[model samples]
Target: MAKKDYYQILGITKSAEEREIKKAYKKLAMKYHPDRNQGDKTAENKFKEIKEAYEILINEEKRTAYDQYGHAAFENGHSNNTYSTFTSSSDFSDIFGDVFGDIFGGNRTKRAKKGSDLCYKMEILLEEAVKGTKKEIHIPTLQKCKKCHGSGASIGTKPYSCSTCNSKGQIHIRKGFFTVQQSCPTCQGRGTIIKHPCNGCHGQGRVETYKTLLVKIPPGIDDNDRIRLNNEGEAGSNGAQSGDLYVQISVKKHPIFEREENNLYCEVPINFTMAALGGEIEVPTLDGRVKLKIPCETQSGKLFRIRGRGVRSMQNRNQGDLLCRVVVETPVNLNEQQKNLLHELGKSFNDFRGENNSPRSKRFFDGVKRFFDDLTR
Candidate 1:
């Protein structure tokens, strides 16, 4: 097989920074990953190709040699290929852990456990989200034990280091010719053992309790926006810092308005008479009711802009406009006198076919007539 340009394989320029190279590598790696593709030979080969390109480009010395001597730099006894040991048999888990720790999470090896983060989904009214408000939330969580002081040891005593792994919290096992790292079975990866455990929390060093927090929601916060409260999550093992609490915001649907990127949209229904004769009507706004002028012979679905009446932007601090779409509503439930008045009014429209009175209908009918005329011909 012919050698391909490493930069071109990763779709990056030769001067691309390390961060840029990693970014491109991650995006392509995820798509062509062997596990995701499963039994597809092409994707497996592509993943191998991407992995090979990345390993060469990510190393500084190898990258410099490649830049100077190209693919020939990695030939026998070359500076770029200095490793003497067999590397093709290295565990895939270790390689992916080193690469995807930044993209996904940390390594697969067991280490010390810490406090787990917590997430709270909060639903707020549209008005409150637009104007900003404070909310009090209560959650059940784990807090560091007052009795143990997070040491997990009984009074007047301290935890002793594990003898199995020598307080390293991990053990290495030789499988055939490969070495695999695993948590110390004696201490469960805590690197220490409490012989005299605290009576209050047994040996966990944390107690379950209820907590109340006052979350101040910012104005113009959109749905799915999260607020992070540090150290509000479950207490860490043995007094480690607590994980964070994430408050996910979800805005309730408004009865009269819908929001879109700082803009407020509303449908205003006007009676046909009010639309034809032109009049002022009251429309509800976030602040209060405002007057809207319906022009004479106003058509349905006409949009009117009320500037600066919408939500203010959180990013740029600029206010958006309120867009009111007027929908001409037909009158219903007519009395005898009203029915008679409408009948007379209808008759006055020249049997409801006058071009001047119903210009849109006239044009529509004219188009329909021409369409049929052409079809017949």
Candidate 2:
């Protein structure tokens, strides 16, 4: 049978853009790759077909010719056979270097790679988060070598232009009927070579050192917050731009409080007497101790909201509220006299049960009775 249409196999129209072509090719290649399919003959054939199709489509000139003349253009030798071109890995480096230069400022191929970014994780107390604080950190990183001043060469000498590429840092290779441009082997892709290397950094231009920086943690900053300091990263070779430093913030666990967004939650233990006869109590807050009133006959797990007592967000002026959950504490380690007094109190509340007793408990027991009665029926 005749071969399937290449465009149809890759699922694209002739008018597809470069990105679309690459996307389609990558999908098909991954699906039928020889390494993935192993002994599957059909998959192997499909892989080769797609590879050939992509090779033609990715090259503008060859793609145009294939579209106009079909496969006959290659058989008749009427078009340039760019698909048969063989390029060295170095050549690919130069092409990417030029492309990266246009996309990100300056040619990366011509300069030493920038140092990697560094992250410093810091833990701050809840009080510190409420009112911003500054901290100093020491980090080890690669800095520009002072001896050679980032040149990677002796003090009196500089790198010389590579002769292989005539300082262009690229070379054209011809294979079969095609030509592909790649980097020059002699100078890699930097176009220059060091004649006398620096002794301090061994020609790398950067050295390992420890650096100190002052990081400011903003107020209201929450856990896992990140702050970035630009150009504070490791030094780049040949005096290229340095990397960046990132400070990650983590809030230490509070002894008496839990944080959620801008809000604060705390559990306050109230004595049984306080729950029985409501009174004022002191609660701890970031600012200071604040007075909170407890109503008479208050029960455990009662939440009290304190407005404007939580956090003030860095971005907004509105402050958050503090939530206090009350837990009635039972008297513990009581003496004989205390036990007798409690027993008298219990006798006084003996008639507090049933309909006139705790109304909530009575209602809950009534619900349970109705539920079991329905189940039995």
Each candidate structure's TM-score, on Cα atoms with residue i matched to residue i, is 0.71, 0.69
lDDT of each: 0.84, 0.79
Off by over 4 Å in 1: 1-111
Clashing pairs in 1: none
**Pairs in steric clash, model 2:** 90-183, 91-182, 91-183, 352-357
Expressed as tens digits, the lDDT of each residue in 278-327 for candidate 2 is 99999998989999999998999999999999989888767998999999
Model 2 residue-pair collision total: 4
Top model number, lDDT: 1
Q: Model 1 Cα displacement at 118 (Å)?
A: 1.3
TM-score of 2: 0.69
| Count of steric clashes across candidates, in order | 0, 4
